[model samples]
Target: MQNDDKYLKSKNENPGSGMPIDEMHELDRTLGFKERRYIEELRILTKSTAIDCIIDDRFERIIYVVRQGDMGIAIGKGGDNIKKMSRVLGKRIEMVEFDEDREVFIANMFKPAEVASVSFGERDEPVMVTVPERGDFGLAIGKGGSTIEKARILVRRFYGKEVGDILIPNRGNL
Candidate 1:
């Protein structure tokens, strides 16, 4: 995740809107040219504003955190929008509906995995995620650990925290 600085945080402006830019952290302000293009493209194609975008080259994926309530529109019926974006960008596209609550947001990041609970750690400590089943554990972690890695990078980027572990209750040898 060395190039995670390219994980751009949206500046809350339209491409052509002549609005004043809001304050952003120095780290959040380091969007690369390609990331800016991706963000703009997301807005144009999906008609949904992406709050953050992570260009994960290792997995050849583009992870977008879209504004809450925009997930359906972004994905479109039968996932047509995602399919189109994937074809256009030459990369897998994943979207997480943004949430203001850190715990809920972390849980949402593990979508399709049935997260049982999210336990937040104290300052600078890693958070713990509990899934309902062993199958959920595998799904949340993903092939070659890609899903969990993406979650870890994004949690650190957006929440300034880490995901210490993802586990299934009453399961052993995972």
Candidate 2:
């Protein structure tokens, strides 16, 4: 039987302009409910501090933006606070250090992947990341490929650095 309903668009179809309010609310309820909950949890966890927590619906992730003075306290000794928060929230939590200088902050995020060097080019630059001999390429990329992708976006957005490619160095060859 042929489906004649014009409103029944495929999942890939983008709801264009002039969309109904109910539709927008439905979309948020469907896709953003969990994310909103996560953001609320972060706010509750850091309510004592002046940190700003933002939930990115597009990325479905939470960012904890903290001032310099509160950074250490937000991430308690041995990361105990973060570990507890992660357990209680049941979502992957990431901390983004807010700096008046965005460039430095982006550079700091890129440090965790063991990137040996970063250089800027006119169009797109390559990032060389060093890994131990037994390092798994999958681990470097991270679960569901979210870690590296987030890092790349953070670098580009904060520093205007175009990372077209990522190179993982072979430790055995070092």
Candidate 3:
């Protein structure tokens, strides 16, 4: 987004600190030329609204990070962009505005699903996230783990936090 933190720009060396050099290299390799092309096409599709996009192959999803207030622009007047892009890319497309705060960023990625909390653990271990109810948890995880896969990837890429799993609270104990 236009108001997003400057660190998220591609010119920056890293989105955040403490990224393993190996993971960075692997990300570039994973993206390669083909994947990068998809992102490029999307950038053109969204015009100047989107800063970048993520092609999460593991989950078959494409996430576009639009400028702070341009989600509508990326989505088009009536979701034409989503329909056309999905048809072209053959993957689910989601548009989310950019944010720098760790918690806000994670919550935005899991839109329509409420996040109870996000806890950071050991340096090498994945972080933990708490959600409520089976239905909301399903939303957080997506139809076949599509959304959560993006959550993990973006969390790592944006905040350098590795997310392990999503947890649900015990309502019976309350």
Candidate 4:
């Protein structure tokens, strides 16, 4: 399907658009009734706009992609908003700040884990994320690969990209 010509314009070509990449790039990110409800609940609770919401039943969590610059509000003072939202939603709450840059967005998804670099693989291959430290590998991947899986899902949702895997120095793909 053809995206809006405006949505296809690059930042350099459309300077000062004041629109986030997620909004600019049209994808198959249609929200379901439950996802919409969750987003509405979060907006009421934190007064932050969620551009996308993913319900990962296997992980028992709802991941909200808050607009950039609105994380502080979505998180609220001392993370009260997240705590409250989690309680109300009856699941773990994960908030990722929206970023126009693909690399920065990937790094944001793997919070607390310092990403050394983000690289794209060959055609049909997944994106490769490198962590600074060996320990960070586990942190980025999360227990049972939940973190990486979630990151892959969101990356595909917004960018239509895949996360091949994460790697660290010395050791190969994990």
lDDT of each: 0.75, 0.49, 0.67, 0.79
Best by TM-score: 4
Q: Positional deviation of 160 in candidate 2, in angstroms?
A: 4.1
Q: Which pairs of residues collide in model 4?
A: 126-164, 127-164
Ranking by TM-score: 4, 1, 3, 2
- In candidate 1, the residue pairs with backbone N, CA or C atoms under 3 Å apart (3 or more residues apart, or in different chains) clash, namely none
Q: Can you give the TM-score per candidate against the true fold?
A: 0.81, 0.49, 0.70, 0.82
Model 4's TM-score against the true structure: 0.82
**Which residue window of length 10 is worst by lDDT in model 3?**
21-30
Write the residue-wise lDDT of candidate 1 on 1-174 in tens digits: 222222233456322112223431223435687877887788888888776788999999999887778899999999999999999999999998877676787888888788898887665577899998888998899899988888898777765567887777776335
Clashes of 1: 0
Task: List model 4 lDDT by residue over 1-174, tens digit each.
Answer: 212243333543321224345544544667799998998999888988877789999999999987778899999999999999999999999998877676787889998789999886544567899897888988898988888888989877766668876888777787
Residue 37 C-alpha lDDT in model 1 = 81
Give per-residue CA lDDT, model 2, range 14-122, as digits (tens). 1221334343223321225554465456556754242334454455665564454566766778887677777886555677565544334444444354544444433
**Clashes by residue pair, model 3:** 1-67, 1-68
At residue 131, candidate 3 shows an lDDT of: 84
- CA lDDT, candidate 4, residue 108: 91
